[model samples]
Target: MDLLFKVYPNLNVEEVATETYLQERSILSARNDDVATLNELAINQFPGELHEYLAADKAIEDDQPIKNRGNIGCPIMLLRNLQPRDGLCNGTRLMVIQFATRVIEAKILNGSHVGNYVFIPRITLQPSVSETPFQMARRQFPVRLAFAMTINKSQGQSVKYVGIDLRNHVFSHGQLYVALSRCTSSNRISVLLGNEDDDKTTNVVYPEVLL
Candidate 1:
C-alpha cells in the first residue's frame, strides 16, 4: 500500500474488507467447531474475504482481479503486446512511476528498455473466459503488478533469475516445464516445495497437450 501512496500520492486504495458469509458452511455446530479447530492448525490460510467470496454462489459474476490501485514505484507487467522496440512488450517487467485516471507513466525495469520511462495508454479489453457473462468491455491500461505472475504469462520470455512456487501444483500441462525454463539455467532458478500434506506440491506434465 505504501507503493500506491508513493506513486499516486493522492489516490486512496480502499481496503477490500472481509464481509460476512450469507449462509453457513455446515448446519451442525460440531462440524463448524471442527473446521475452526483445523483452521487453527493450518498455516498460511486463505484470506477471509477470499474464503467467503469463493464460497459464494455468484463469485464469478463480478470476478475481475483488482488492478486500479497500483502504487508508484511498484513493479508492473505489461498485459498487452506493445512497443517491443521500446521494451514494453507483454510480460515485460516495468516500474510504475506515475499513475493517472487515464494514462500511466512507468519505467521499464527489464530488457533493453531498462531504466527508460514510458507512457502507457488505455486500451479496450475483454475477458476471454467463456463463463464471463455479459462480455463486458473495459477501457483501461493493460497492466498488472509484476510482484507475482503465472507461468503461462511468463512464457516466451527469459529472465536472469526465476522463482517457482509449486505448492499449488500445475493445473494445466507444461506449466512446470515453462516455469523452470524461464531462467537461463538451473543455477538461476529456485523452486519452493510444500510439506507432505500439500497434495498439489508436485511438478506435473501433460504429454497429450504437448502433442
Candidate 2:
C-alpha cells in the first residue's frame, strides 16, 4: 500500500481513495462474514507481529508479508483462486496490463494462463474452516504485489529463482523445505547464512506433519 501508492500510479478513485474495500466494520466476525478484511488483516497484522517477535527471539526476520501498492508493469500475485482455464489461480503470477480506479487488467505470467489478459474484479471470499474467530468474509480486490510472498502463500507455486536469507532462523515447520522447493532446481538458489550459525541449527522444522 505505502510502497504501491508511492511507487505506482495510485488507481484508487478520489471518491474512494481507500486502499482496501473493507472498512472497520468488516473485522469482527468469525464465520467469514468479512472475508476480505480478515484476509487483509491476516496478511498485515499477526504475521508481521510474529515476524518482529521472532526477530526479537533470534528467528527469521525476512518472513514478513509484503504490502505492495501495485503499479503498471509491476508483477503481482492473485490472492484468491479464480478462472483456472485462463490460467488464474491462487498463486498465479502476472504483470499489470492496465489499471482503472475500480478495475485492474493484467496479463498472466504463470501457469497455463501465461500471456492471457485478465480483468480482476472485487470478489467475496470465505475460509473453508469455521473453527476460528474472525472467520469473517468480505469483498475486495484479490491481488498482492509479487515482489515477495510469504512461505505459507508460496506453497504449490514454482518460481524461477529462490533466495533464502536466514538472518533470523526459520521459526515454523517446513518453512525451509517450502522455500527451497519453490525453485525448480538447486542451482537456482542463493542462500545467505550469517557466520555465527551452524547449518544444522538454521534449517529448522517440525518432526512429523507439516506444510
Provide TM-scores for the models.
Answer: 0.56, 0.55
lDDT of 1 by residue, 73-140 (tens): 54557879878888889877776666665678887766676778899888777667857445655666
Structure candidate 1, residue pairs in collision: 3-71, 4-71, 7-72
Q: Worst ten-residue run, lDDT, model 1?
A: 20-29
How big is the positional error of residue 197 in model 2, measured in Å on the Cα after superposition?
3.2
Overall lDDT per candidate, in order of appearance? 0.51, 0.51
